[model samples]
Target chain A: MITRRLPPWFVNALLVPLASVLCGFVVAGLVVAATGSDPIAAFSSLFQGAFTNQDAFAETLVSTTPYLFLGLGIALGFRAGLFNIGAEGQYYVGGLAGVFLAYSIHGVPGLIEIPLALAAGMLGGFVWSGIAGALKARFGAHEVITTIMLNYVAFLLANYLIDGGLMLAPHVSTPRTPEIDANAQLPIIIAGTRLHFGLILALVAVPLVWFLLQRTTLGFRLRSVGFNPTAARANGMSVGQTLVLSMGISGALAGLAGIVDILGVSHHMTDTVGAGYGFDAIAVALLARSNPWGVLPAALLFGALRNGASFMQLDTQVSSDLISVVQATVIIFVAAPVLVRWIFRLRRQQVAEVQITQREETAAV
Target chain B: MEFLSHQDVVGLLAQTLVTATPLTLAALGGIMCERSGVVNIALEGIMLTGAFVGYAVALATHNVWLGVLAAVVAGMLIATLHAALSVSLMVDQIVSGMVINILAVGITGVFYRNYIESSGLAGPDTLPHWNIPGLSALPVLGRIFFQNQFVTYAMLILIFAVHVVIFKTVWGLRTRACGENPAAAETAGINVYFVRYINVITSGALAGLGGAYFSLQQIGNFLPNMTGGRGFIALAAMIFGKWTPIGAFGASQLFAFSDALGSRLQIANVHIPIQFLGMLPYLVTIVVLAGAMGRAVAPAAVGKPYRRS
Candidate 1:
């Protein structure tokens, strides 16, 4: 079934994603109409809201900052054939660690404090991901169940701390942490918009990840292990160690995503901080086919769609929740590339679509 | 204190059994699907689909059995959809299950909202409780077993039947073969895909029956996400039970007891961070799963697509 005929230049690699986006907008339009609203008018407003003003474009990029980091983190792990579903939990732990380090070590210089907090967050994410890796390597515990269960643990644990132990604002009628010191805050890249140095930091990380993956011995081992652990082990590589390290690196990247939100953007920590970035990152990474460099564009697209959704709702009278439906549909198409191929009558894929699931991918275990 | 007296203990156990009925049945369904080598992660989705269909039919026809029938049929239908996507198309099974789960959540949430907020339909007729004739009057054990709805008894019977069918029959052997090693079984002249297909759909029907218990037996109204990770918990139990039907049944009871205990503790006003206490079952499930680490191996061909390579 491996079709030797390559797809036409236009309907090939780039077109699928473009077509998926068109499919998304069409669905978005219908949803707007179904709500008794004008689709074209709503979309125009959404477009204007997202891009017309400098501030709006900045805001879209601001939101894109975290998605880019987290997407790349998961993307790296995905290339190694590891699914780090615990990215959300890792992000939570990382955010808390970054905020905690910033608040406690106030006297440090700006350069030192900011880097320290990021390191703390990355360390938090690294440790969290390490748990999954150790389980996979030593115990053969499935990451899926462990990851989901750990999410509840991380969330509840973080909730308890914010709600009681580290109550920075107990009288504020909400569970949230105090703001980090001014020295720890990431500077604004734009004069007025919410966009900060985090976007630059995220951009820097993309190329750094690509380089480390493409030109390093460690990256080769990780990819080898991902492609086939048995073969890698036979080739004298430490498969288990590579898995743990890959997981840790994945978590570290995810952790950086959390730090970007708290120190670089929000300037404070709260319960809603992660805000589904972990899950959204999955879509971003998947859309990029786990390519580190590709994640930026995928993330920006998601960022734009999400950024425009509110205006889409307000102006077109579309149910904003349809964004959720559209998002899930994109996930369906990406995860099942066969559907995308079937829809376009694609010549058979050159390579099989990568099976990204960990284990017991079926319902049983 | 009064809730735990020896005499009152029997009553609590009786209530526990009734409460555990659906979870138990659902776990059994979960066990069958897993044993047959299909990751039945869509237990929640299938259960939701069953719940929706059962409620819709019961409301339309006003017949309790018809509602149950519709649920079973609908469950099989959804199962077939899942099977085709996962088993046939060779998509990632986890994503396939997740697709069903998300679709179920979105569809049921939208439809349930429409039904309640806009449809203006009156409530469907619910089943009446049935009591065993002479057995209902005896002491503790008698009351425990005899005083319950028809689904409760049917649940127990069905589980036992699954036990018999799985352990005592040839079909069960073939089904197990598919899960444990499909390629070898196919070489052995067993129709691996056919066996898996039947088992998966049967399990879906079972999940559907478990769902009917929610709408028709437990409550007349359908609430969104009412399955509430019970499907995942059942998955945990299925593995914790070593992929055996009876083992899964016991595991479900253990989880049900945890749920019952959590409720009782909340009512008792135990000041212990109910959060940590509330975290008990999930935490225990985590520990139990970890303990089973490197121990409970999945079917060798659990997620591999058969392409005659």
Candidate 2:
């Protein structure tokens, strides 16, 4: 019999992402060239801006913090077969709740106050996302539609609170809440940069999420439910409960992203706080193949692109929106691996099996 | 308090029709795609692409019709990409649609900022209102139906056309069969893939026309992400109507009426916060969706990619 060899797991893992990222750059380069800019010069500037100096590097890290948190949250949802598109709304609610608590509670010790504010943020996100989760669990409402609807509701609610003077700063004219208490503020880790303790928390969260998803019985049930809900229910797993718990945890993580943004970066909640991090985290999670451990690198790559976009714009007169193009192309390439495989002329073996299984599940439904 | 007047009511109804036109078109498009077994959440993106392309071409050619044509083509292009991914490549339909949305936004934003902004031109001319001769003279009906832009009339006609075609045509039956049970359709010797591709592409064209309405008719220019969440609302409308053309049109009218009423309330200096008024349509969508979930069953094969063994 002819022997067939499978590529090593590490090699296969790296190959797809690497090829897709390279394809993204290639497409982005074409777009840049079409716009009459030299792609090499623009990209070199991007690299220099992201990593060349201390301030730039710290800024990259600062951007990475939210992505890491949001990506982990989204990855968790994906693992549970839930699409939590409302992470943006959840982030907004979390920030609002954290700042609201920070403003209301006073004179508490720093040790007690900080965690309390953060917990409030998580509670806020949990409640917001829990609406969609509970609706999905109880009413059979699709999470995708409910989450998207909730996003608009969250925006309008935030707008109402800020503009209606409920949460507006006392002496400020802008649409923002008052600064949080000093005791609740996350300390800056790097002296001269915006880098703060939030990065440490984000880093710690990576392994924690990995452990939760890989090493725990709860994770097994969640994965089982995701793989086949009917089978999982037959096996005595409470699919509904698993969905609610996974979504709750996902919302909690996204809420932490909001709190981190407030405490470590903004120090106050603005209407635009945590602006696109929730959406960008979807890309981050996809790039990581929904693997919690892989989210760190994925988040870092996106953070660098976002951080360096301005430099690319300034140097090449190319609009920073090119990064969005790059990002979109990356997703397209990843989602349609057939295109990538065709372009690279790589042999596909186990990947086809995964696709077939996914199709079967859809068909079975 | 005499808060309402006859003229105001007439004007509001006219405004409601105008506002509902785009949504009606998009929802009908959504119905077509869903009936052919594809879940198209990318309607938002498709609409944006149409708006941007329509505006750009209209500006370049100084002809609104050409702009509309270009918008439809652009929409079809994106839809074709989505079809390739979701149908041919057998990718997850939702993820494919989401990527299409991101791609549309990125493409439109990049082109608008890099190419259009530097050109230093003003917005294109808006579409002219078309008043039917005899119908324009009717007492209440004229103001509600006759005095509107060309697109509003087209939308009404298209709604009737789609309803008739979907309910009365052999092709419609095949398309619905593909969605309800593709395997059965295949066994009956129907070309499921071809039927789906045609319906989906046509759906894109219709959504593109809706996008063109925003630029060429409604606002006369495209803004970044001008479609906002209307596409999602249209999806909600589609579901609310149980994926029927006339049903979706009715749902669209209800949403558009609420939207028009909200703006009218704001203009009337109502004491309620404007944001709360702004929240009305989305709130209604959630309530409607939640209330209709168990009762509204989607086409059985929707969101599934059919692969021949």
Model 1, A31-132: lDDT tens per residue?
Answer: 556545677886777777677744778888987888898898888887676777778888998888888888888688989999999999999999988887
Chain A of candidate 2 gets a TM-score of 0.93
Q: Is the docking of candidate 2 incorrect, acceptable, medium or high quality?
A: medium
* Backbone clashes in model 1, listed as residue pairs: A362-B39, A363-B39, A363-B40, A363-B41, A364-B39, A364-B40
Clash-forming residue pairs, model 2: none
- The fraction of reference A/B contacts recovered in model 1 reads 0.22
Output the lDDT of residue A105, model 1. Answer: 80
Prediction 2 TM-score vs. true: 0.95
Task: Kindly list the per-residue Cα lDDT of model 2 for residues B1-309, writing each as its tens digit.
Answer: 245698888888888888888888889888888898988888988999999999999999999889989988888888888888888888778777888787887778777877788888887889888889999999989999998887788889999888877778988899999999999999999899898888888888989999999999988988888888788878878877778888888888888887888778877887677777666666666666566444566788888889987
